[model samples]
Target chain A: MEFQEAWPYVVGVYMSIWAVLLIYVIVLQNKLAAVKRELGSLSKAVERKG
Target chain B: MKKSSLILASAGALLLMAGVYLAFFVAPDTVVRIDDRELVQFSQKIFYFHVPVAETSFVFLVLGGLFGAMFLGTRKRSYEQMSYAAVEVGFIFVLLVMITGVLWTRAAWNVWWEWEPRLTTFLVLTLMYSGYFVLRSSVQEESAKARFGAIFSIIAAVNVPLTFVAGRLDSLKPVHPKVFTLQGASMEGPMLAAFLVSMFGMLLFATSLYIMRLDLLRAREDIEYLKEELEVG
Candidate 1:
């Protein structure tokens, strides 16, 4: 196959890896932040009740 | 994030970048000769990342099954959480492998997909794992959910080796290239170096993701327990 014909697949494979990693990391960060916030509130609730 | 996980992620990212550089700039292009004509296959570059991701997915799925079995034997909440996290991370890598594999297939085989043994078995593995999440959601009782999930995970893990060997079995007639066999890898020094670096990086990155997901699962469980305690108090 011609070099030009095959280069797009190489680029696509690399781009897919990068894209998936970026999206996964972002999702994890958001979930972590949300969990931390919930935990903080729960801790305060316990302290206030005690 | 945990310090260890962060360190692993950073190191993995760096190695992956280095692998990319080596793949493009250092490793020689793969050339195939047919009828006295040499063809340079630029698409073979995808092999470095595609195989690594596929192998890494296998590792995570196997770990998930091991953890699931441990959870069943000991009834440990931590093991259950670890199994769930590993499966989730494994699912992500499996999806990546499918995507990259399709692209490579298009480039190399001039087709989007084929029904060869390796690809067919891998597709089955992916679908089975996808059902894992659906099964997890469908069950109502917590204990039952965990029980069923663990059982399914173990069953699914058995397919991993089957998929790996499908390409190598003579009767299967798989078009998938077998780079590592009983003999050894078929590539040269620089190509091997690139593959090793990428493989390690992919494994570490998946590990980091697994750790993060495990922490999240535990946090959610803790919150549930705390909420129950508060309600009782």
Candidate 2:
């Protein structure tokens, strides 16, 4: 196949990959909520232990 | 811009140009079997960029393991965040490798996937690394999560090279079936130049991404710290 004909495959792959990345980033942001809550509670414990 | 970003961006551009030039011009075009009957020409050209960068993904996987081990040894949370960022990048690159591999397989083998040894190893590696993130998220304690994440990262990383070696071993079954031996890898002048450019460019790109993600994670940690400080004050 010629380069022009196969170029679509590359583009499609790129697009799909980016979509997955976007979903991951969103999930990461959601995950930060858990991190923040842990930090809130854990720092208090660290302070008390010290 | 940060120093690392500046260096990486410039290097990535130069490398990208060189790799592209070499792949399109210097390397010889390949004719691969598209199907039992049909053959695909020029489709094999993707190897120059696809294979080397695919190989480079291992760098991040190992880095993730090292940082995880460091965190466990020192009980430092910085190491956990660092490991997390690296694994995130590693996951992205692995996905890219799978996509490129699938494309190559379709064009070369007329199939999307097979349970071949190397490919299966990669699939397992991907799952193992994903488990690292999942394990981290499941626990609630900050230090425990950090410690657990670090340990998991090390274990997950150890799997990557073993997977690679196992895959290579499986490919040596010449007695059962004949396989294409890519014996001649001679690169013409232009093809070599293009390959160098692309590989270097990708390296830069991956580096830039690593730095950016690390910074983001650090900043998030800082904000959490500040909030805790305010509550105490």
Candidate 3:
């Protein structure tokens, strides 16, 4: 297959790979930050009680 | 994220980029020679990413099963968390595999999907593992949820190998390509290098994600425990 002929499929595959990975990493980062925030608040609550 | 997982993720990203470069520039385009003609398979470049993602998913799911077994044997919370994390990360890779695979199928076979042995078995494998999450969420008790999830993970892992071999089995008449056989891999030279680099990169990346998710699960558990203690006091 010539590059011209195969470009669509090749581009689609790479695009899907990177797009899915980028979305997943972004989601994971946001979830991690949220967890950290919750944990920090919980620690403060415990400290105040103590 | 932990320092170790961060380093792993960075290294994995670097290697994957190198793999892409090698796959495009260094690896020779696939060619087939007939008596009077040569055909170049440009779309075959997708192999560099597709196979690696599929293999990585298999590795994670297998690890998920192993962790599930450990949890069952020791009744440990950490093992259960690890198993869940592995499945979640593995599921992401599996989805990528399906997407890239569909593109490849269309390019090579002129069809988006075929109900062949490999494809059917793989679809079943995906659905079975997906049910693992649904099973966990449906259960109300922590211990019971973990136990059922562990058992499901083990059972699901069994399907992974079946999916892998479905194409090769004699009766199946599969259209899927078999890259590895008893003798050796079918690829060589720069092609093999690209594949190996991508494979290891994907494994490391998935491991980093698994560690990150596991840490989050542990933190959530700790938060729940502290909240319960605070309420009791």
Q: How close is each model in CA RMSD to the real structure?
A: 0.9, 6.2, 1.3
Q: For model 3, how does the per-residue alpha-carbon lDDT over B1-233 read when each residue is reduced to its tens digit?
A: 78988998999989999999999999999987878798888989999999999999999999999999999999989999999999999999989988998889888888999999998988898899889989999999999999999999999999889998898997879889898899999988889999999889988888888888888899899889889867976
- Evaluated with DockQ, which candidate comes out highest? 1
lDDT of 3 by residue, A1-50 (tens): 66778889998988888888878877888888898898889888888888
Question: Chain B of candidate 2 versus the native chain B: what TM-score?
Answer: 0.84
Error of 3 at A21 (Å): 1.5
B91-179: candidate 1 lDDT, tens digit per residue: 99999999999999999999999999999999999999999999999999999999899989999999899998899898988899989
Alpha carbon deviation, residue B202, candidate 2 (Å): 1.5
Stretches > 4 Å off in candidate 1 = none
Model 3, position A50, has a per-residue lDDT of 87
Worst 10 residues of 2 chain B by lDDT: B172-181
- Rank order by lDDT, top first? 1, 3, 2
lDDT of 2 by residue, B1-233 (tens): 35786588678756665666666656666555555754446665666656655655788888888998888788777887888888888878888788877886665556788777677777888888878779888999988888887888888888778766655464543111112235643655666556656666766777776776776687677766766665666
The runs of at least 3 residues in candidate 3 whose Cα sits more than 4 Å from the true structure, single-residue gaps closed, are none
**What lDDT is reached at residue B193 by model 2?**
58
Q: lDDT: which is higher, 2 or 3?
A: 3
Superposed Cα deviation of residue B96, candidate 1 (Å): 0.5
Q: For each candidate, what's the DockQ?
A: 0.78, 0.15, 0.74
